[model samples]
Target: MITEDSEFLKGVKEDDNSSFKAIYEKYSRDLFVYAYNIIKEKTVCEDIIQEVFISLWAKRKTTTITSLKPYLFQAVKFQIFNHFRNNKFSREDLTRLNIIDVSMNVSQKLEYSELDQIIRDHVAKLPKRCRHIFVLSRYHHKSNKEIADELEISVQAVKNQISKALAFLRNNLQLEEVAFISLILLQ
Candidate 1:
């Protein structure tokens, strides 16, 4: 069955100009806002979205876009990330990029990745319920109530399991300088 949702993708893949225009009109504003929020520059955000659209149009015949919205947003995200990475950041600029650490030195990013891997290993060792709750909270970014509902547990139980998991990680891991840089970035 050809889903109504994918009509646009199919039209685009078949080199239909109206489909490309409709897709742009639908997603461009939201994409621009997302890029602007991350980059805090109007011109750069505009250019990024333009580049994303142009790239999408170019790749339409060759690439499969099952979900148009994510493909658009992900392209903008990569462009924004590239902008941050290619350009030098002042300490002030670094502070504004939010929790994303584009300013991290190569070695610091490496340390951060190593620390993250170690933490994931320890998370895997947790009891099943605790690990599930913690993964929902951290990796999946779910609220306590949401996790509770999904797991059929009390909100307090969700909180307790997340807390227990965090406490376990704290005891097991030695987060030092590299992690401190991450903390500073978050602040």
Candidate 2:
């Protein structure tokens, strides 16, 4: 027997409007909840969900989504990350966004919050120059060249300072925490 997901995919591939509407009705609320946990803004979350569905419809003829739920969730995650990155959110905002998992239990959320605080505290402990370079690169989304030019330093100096800052942070945080922080910084 063909699975429900396959049935949906077939309908979507055939450009059926009702199928598209069905997909949206099924996934939009969960996607919105997932996004809101990170973005904490109703309007922006709604817009992101709308964009995802719009893109889905636009790509339906060409795209093949084997698993709709994961695909939708991943799209929402990327959109939320882009929103955070484009808006130049602060480290605190990044921290809040990074550690949130809507599927997590209460204890997990508390653990994530503690880890977030640890990362923030360690970042605060970096030397002034290192912290400046790190913040310029990560929080402000500045290129190494831009940061160097603004600081009146060589690009290599900026790179070195960022490296040093990351090294310092790595020394204090666990491997998983470091990875999580790196994901936020790099993205």
Candidate 3:
């Protein structure tokens, strides 16, 4: 937790309205924009933000928040994901939301959408352990050390597994395409 947000979390846990409002004011706009990017619906995005803040306040006392910013963002993400999932979204639509890379332009996002589908198809063929590690490192953005800790494995093993996964992807994808995907995904 950052020192600043830790203070907010402490105050919120003690039912301080000002602390809760401070956190809301700081994050709500950013959260709305983030949700809007994926959802592209202003009303839905606003509702998701409201729901996230409400959930945060409702659970402040019981939830073990290690990082307040990430927890709040993730809550908004969860709501959006569920909204898509429960509304009969196609696999491609979900994939578009699943890879929310704001760095890409409209055309690149379309291109990546097609490319992402291809990569996912190939990634599905990976061994279970390799697939899990790759998803953790690329999709979830977990550090190799963090993944190793969570998986109860050595850092060396994590590195070797990631190497194997990348090698497998390189072999299966366009000879040079995985390089581009890796650059973005590894970020």
Candidate 4:
């Protein structure tokens, strides 16, 4: 029998069903474990693993993975990071900086992701460099030096970019405007 990794490589290269099944059966548990380590939320970890596999299968023909295990685990890690990074709480923390009260209601729960997406859409419109600096500082909580190193710029440049971006956002958004946007985006 072809080794499981070999099967996956073949499927990824050839779109073969048997190889795909072998790949799924062999790696699902490992993928789940990897995702759990990064995500810590059981439900979210499971979701990440599922999405990883679905994406793997969908993109199999175009993928050129030399090592199935590491590639899958890294994919899981990236997915987990993206989910938490995109979660509503991060956006709320950014614009509101206030503690939120959660109630036990389906509608309330369902509104969060919608709001996050809305805010993300607006943030995406920001200039590319400004957006990168802002997210690194706000979401990733990186220091100026860290952001500078990551972006391969001077620390002063990092600080200047953040200041300019914040000033622009503040000018464009008044208190009421920010509050309204926050409520609508984070509803």
List the RMSD of every prediction in angstroms. 6.5, 16.2, 11.2, 11.0
lDDT string, candidate 3, 33-136, tens digits? 76786778999999899899999999998999987776776687668766764587665563344434335599978876777788888888989998898888
Evaluated at residue 127, the lDDT of candidate 1 is 100
| Global lDDT scores for all candidate models | 0.72, 0.76, 0.75, 0.64
Q: Give the C-alpha miss distance for residue 32 in model 4, angstroms.
A: 0.8
- lDDT for predicted candidate 3 compared with the true structure: 0.75
The residue ranges of model 4 lying beyond 4 angstroms of the native Cα positions read 1-4, 88-187
Worst 10 residues of 4 by lDDT: 178-187
lDDT score for candidate 4 against the true structure: 0.64
Assess the local accuracy of residue 25 in candidate 4 as a C-alpha lDDT between 0 and 100. Answer: 84
List model 1 lDDT by residue over 1-187, tens digit each: 8765489888888899998898888888988877786677999999999999899888888888776665676677668767876798765554444334445789978866776677678889999989988877766545689899998989999989888886787677664522332221111
Q: Each prediction's TM-score against the native?
A: 0.55, 0.55, 0.55, 0.44
Residue 106's lDDT in candidate 1: 95
Task: Tell me how far the alpha carbon of residue 92 in candidate 2 is from the true structure, in angstroms, after superposition.
Answer: 2.1
Q: Give the poorly placed runs of model 2, Cα more than 4 Å off.
A: 99-187
